[model samples]
Target: MLTKDDVRGVSAMIPTPCKEGQGGWQYEDSVDLDETARMTEQLIAAGIGSIAANGTTGECAALTLEEKLAFTRTIIEVARGRVPVFAGITTLGTKETVRQMRKFRELGVEGGFVGLPLWQTPTITNSVKFYADLAEAVPEMALMVYANPLFFKSTFPVEFWEGVGKHCPTVVTCKYVGNLMDPKNMLIDLPASMDAAPHVQFLPIDFAAPMAYDLVGDRLKGMWSTSCAMGPEPVVALQRAIDAGDKARMGEIMHDLHGLPNAIPDFKEFSKYNVQVEKIRCNAAGYIKAGPCRAPYEDLPDDWRALTVASGKAWAELCARKYR
Candidate 1:
């Protein structure tokens, strides 16, 4: 089984590929395994430490159980132990979540990030039990818990994390997507409180990684990057800057990356279209074929193609910069 430190470094979140349909909308067949496996190989070649498939970036909630397992197996098969591969085990049922993790473990995946079951946010006792049960069910597989306010309805206090860390030895990472301010406090205070859960590393979500890296420094060594899946070089370059403590280069890389999301006009309006944007970015970077997201997610905006291309080129240029 993988440990917390073993899973450190750049983990890319892959976007699911879909088959194009009439009116440019995506159909149920959008999950193309061959394309996904190809994308995973590309990220590994680009120096990503791990591959996180079926996460929110992969549109986890949108995929069926079979599709999720297929994605995990494809990643594992393509990766061939070159690096750790993680599947997102977020589903609506507790037993179902465990079932998926077991499947991933059976396929030889090292670990995965899991979110709470959908629709219902149980009390702290039940929540703690949920994680404990999950760990017990899949004792051999390492796990990361995703705590995002935007995605989850209830507040998961640090104490809850402490409980998970204490009880679930397999829980090695916590991807905290709550307020940016929260990590600051956790960085200062939570370590001692969470000592019982010694191996559980805390990380901010991908979008907030730059700020988190800047503030938390070495304590927060690894990150999960969505942009890196589409374009790993830029994100890897940024990580190198942070590791070397090159504030100037870090600033330069940030300058290049910080504005990328905004390149889409009315970004806030289409902000919820994350998987679609990632697909566009990945396609622009030549990692996969460009296509639309599945149902309920409308077609990519008119200007997204142009903006994604611009963003991809600019990012590639930044990646070429000398970090030494």
Candidate 2:
């Protein structure tokens, strides 16, 4: 089974590349496997610590089971065990989630990123049971809890983590996009959640990472980043600074990051079109071809498009200077 030690640095949540003219969610065999392989190689070469695909950023909801399986296989083949690879196995119910995870495990994925079943808001007891059941069923597969309050019903409170620590041993990490709206909640929850589930690494997203690392020291372990899709070097540089305890350097990188055009002042507004914005930035960065946002979520407001593209271009420029 995987452990907290197995996950480190920047864990990149990458986008799925859609084939030309096939960006619609319902399009059959729309995933570009060759590009997927190339993208995987690009990330590994650029020093990403680990790679996760088919999450919110990867358009997990829009991908067909066959496409997801193919995408997972492509990434695993390209990675060739160079860096740990995780594939999202989130579904609307427990049975399907387990089924998808089993398939991905067969394809040699290191772990599965799972979110809570989304049909209804699960009670805290049921939430714990959901993870426990998955662990029990797929004892060989390690799990990363996808704890995003914006997409899922559960906020993943301290109580949930306490139950997971006791009942779900295979859960080794979390893609923690915690309560960003209430910064005070994070001030309370980050420490308390870690205390409740000491064995699991709670990886805060890129924006919140510096604070999280300072709050918990080495226990912060790593971070989950969608922006790394723009390019990993800048994000990896931040990881190195954090590890070296270079607070000044950390501030420098973060300041430039916050200066990006897509770094909206209000996170709530940003969340509304995050999936689309990420795709725009990734395409603009041109680090790897991210193709287009999959259907139903593809459209972005005109102002958001302009800013997002500008952010992507700005990131590419910053990356050129190596975030000087």
Model 1: per-residue Cα lDDT over 1-324, one tens digit each: 888877666777777776555213234445677777778778788777777677775777676777677777887888899887778888787888887787778878778788877778667777788788888888888887777655666466767777876787888877665553344443433344246467787665555556666565666666777777546776777666766777787687767777554545553454476666676666666546635566555566668767866776665555555321
Which parts of model 2 have CA positions greater than 4 angstroms off? Answer: 183-187, 263-266
Q: CA lDDT of each candidate? A: 0.69, 0.85
Candidate 1: residue 97 Cα off by (Å): 1.2
Clashing pairs for predicted structure model 1, backbone only: 18-30, 19-30
Tell me the TM-score of model 2. Answer: 0.96
Question: Worst lDDT window (10 residues) for model 2?
Answer: 262-271
Prediction RMSDs, each to the true structure? 3.6, 1.5
Question: Which candidate number maximizes TM-score?
Answer: 2
Candidate 1 contains a number of clashing pairs equal to 2
lDDT of 2 by residue, 81-167 (tens): 888888989999999999988899889887999999978988999999999999999999999999988888888999999999899
